[model samples]
Target: MKINGFRGRLITADHADYDTARAVWNGAVDRRPRLIARCGGSADVAAAVRFARDHDLEIAVRGGGHNVAGTAVCEDGIVIDLSAMRAVRVDPAGRTARVQGGALWGDVDHTTQAHALATTGGIVSHTGVAGLTLGGGIGFLMRAHGLTVDNLLAAEVVTAEGDVVRASADEHPDLFWALRGGGGNFGVVSSFRFALHPVGPTVLAGPIFWAADDTTEVLRFYRDFAAEAPDELGTVVRLGTVPPLPAIPAELHWRPAVAVICCYAGAVDDGERAVRALRRFGTPLVDLLAPTRYAAFQAATDDTVLHGWHYYWKSTNLAGLSDDTIAVITDHAYAARSPRSYSAMFHMGGAVARVPQDATAYAGREVAHNIIIDGVWLPAESGKHAAAETAWARRFLQALQPHRATGVYVNFLDSDDDTGRVREAYGDRTYRRLAEVKAKYDPDNAFHHNKNIGPG
Candidate 1:
């Protein structure tokens, strides 16, 4: 098949950079695309989409390519690579930002921080703003400012049929609603306009850890503490084996611990008072909570979750953290085979829930918490430890099934099928609406690499 009219870098399998072009964040995915089009701008994106449609080729869209499931690449197909378009324009006067789809969270954060403004973004600095925001973005500022989608003002997208269009509250209203939380199933988002808020140049943030044996006490306090915690305080409870890293005290290396990672996005004086009870909760092994730059705090965990590591993630929303659920979670926390594996519970309420459930496609606004079981292991010879690490994560998820809520965060979903998991993520009503929108925008399911809602 011959193709032309592309004004971007069109790399075939024989290209020298083909191998690197096909690589994504998850080393577990090793698919090779037949062609990759490195888009330079929105017009390039539209041209690629048109060429793919003309050839009847399956399409994969790559932004920052940080998806844990590695849906950014596909086998024997065309990939619209957007990584080269990482431009960010901040409008301090309007308190908003115009971000290219390929720009990472760090790009948006750093640019907006210069203006003392920010929007909710992923904790990982390198995560793509497009993917995370489309899947209902969660981050340190979630409680204070709501999910990233909540701040989205507009988007420039290339539809499956190769039309460049804008989506917002007034234009393409249904498409706008679906874009808020519907993965990349509708089109390739070329640029995003986000409403920014006065977050911080500095905020009191960091983790407070306690010995693993104190899990029960710590969890009980966390459960109650978060129940009435102010919206400015966003917290996450993590159960994992401490890595032997320089940031950690050498003596506590490789020890088991339960920690509350805090991000207080309010006044320094108010943040200190808000987190005082948490700091004084039990004899914490270490308290690293202090005023720090928000962008710095967002990138603090970059070393641990770097690219090239094999990753499998499972998650479920919970009505709230219960005593029984905590017991089950802590029981499996100790059984993780990899030091990088962990079980995390994110406090989900405040601004996220204040928005009505049907306000957007993002379901589970009423959910009180979300548990993510992350299984990560360093690359091993012959992939010997892959089975063991994955099994541990699955078992941990199975144990929590009884306490699982009806909905799950679309961003945290790992499966790529139209199964019950996908249905549960959006619920029946929202799922139906998503299917209608999917049919309208991408009738042939050209963008089905994500947790897809079919064009029924």
Candidate 2:
């Protein structure tokens, strides 16, 4: 079990930390890898990859280990854990951040905020930058900036062939293109260089909620308003039972509600003007919209969405929020198997659509809403409610099929068996190109743990 040229901790099943090391974000996944290489840097990562290949071991790469599908851990294989390699170097003059692959959104946010700079990142602070960026990241900055992939300037990757290489617009441009939205099928990215924008230490952001009974009117207003809203105003509508948090009014706890979480990534004056209309609409049960620190706003939902939750998420690109689509969503939201489960409708028209469809590996550029159905249940009661939650999500997705676009977000897909779904995520032409890229980079499909595009 010697990993030649390796200079990192190697853990086997007998190791004291084996059980803890194997745990990922999804509580439902309980895998025990034959070996876990706690990679320290690019050299450790390269050595681990080579070890996995030479030993005929299936490879699983772990960054922040936040993938809902639990692709970061594998049973009876080699796990290249990059958790130890988190280093964020921000070049204030260049307005860019060179981040190690294992860094999370929180890590990047903390560093970039010191210079009053930022980039598109996941809503949850703990979500991995690498996975989310590779899978086409969507976040509060999406409207103002773009997907995380769009902000990505360059990457240093260790290919499946065990070679270290750099991919960027000026060097290995095709590989760079693939790295943007293509999943980890090509190689193990050791670090990323992201082009940062002048965002804020503070911005106007938070949630405005109405009773579920007001879903129809609230949605209608949102449909028309968000479509034409300024790029700086990023809004997302969530339909779910309110969690019993201290922030919520005591009476409103566990109540069914339709909420619009808004983040205006611009001047306080402009942001106030932008969100004024949304704030005025409908009889809101709760309106927490206010000027807040960008870092605080980004990590606001961290408490509710902590790790080790059983999550089954299904997503589709919506043509638009038509009347029928709204009705279907409302009905399913009310019938959710668990109160923790909810549906999210992200308003994605501004900067996201400005990028052409073929500019990167990401699909569904022109779509209006990114619809995600999150089916969640406590792992402690998984035996009692897991099946019901998953079934509910599937049925809800099926109900929305008529209103769904042909493409879906690959990262949001949960079912591991659905290879056809992966193809649908990218259309025939793009998928074919991805396959060709796979052939050039990883013909053996060494990195098939994600939504794979095998060499055809």
Candidate achieving the largest TM-score? 2
Model 1 spans with C-alpha error above 4 angstroms: 1-3, 381-384, 416-419
Candidate 2 TM-score versus the reference: 0.98
Candidate 2 lDDT (Cα, 0 to 1): 0.90
lDDT of 1 by residue, 1-456 (tens): 334556778888888898988999888789989899999988889889988888888898999998887888988989999999899999999998999999999999899999888999998899999899999998888998999999999999999988999999999989999999988989999999999999889989999989999998899888889998999999988899776656679898768999899999888899999999999988999898999999999998888787898888888898567899889988998787777888788998999999988888999798889988888888772266578778888888889989888888888877443145888889899999999999999999988877788997
For model 2, the superposed segments whose C-alpha errors exceed 4 Å read: none
Total clashing pairs for each candidate: 0, 0
The local lDDT score (0 to 100) that residue 448 gets in candidate 1 is 83
TM-score per candidate, in order? 0.97, 0.98
lDDT of 2 by residue, 1-456 (tens): 679999999999999999999999988889999999999999999999998998899999999999888999998999999998889999999999999999999999999999999999998899998899998999989988999999999999999988899999998888898988888989999999999999889888889989999999999899889877999998889889887777778999879999999888899899999888888997899998998989988888886767888888888888778999889888887787688888888888788889998989998788889788888888887987788888888888999999987799888988564556998988999899889999999989999988888987
- Report the lDDT of model 1 for residue 446: 85
Winning model by lDDT: 2
The worst-scoring run of ten residues by lDDT in candidate 1 lies at: 411-420
What's the lDDT for all of these models? 0.88, 0.90
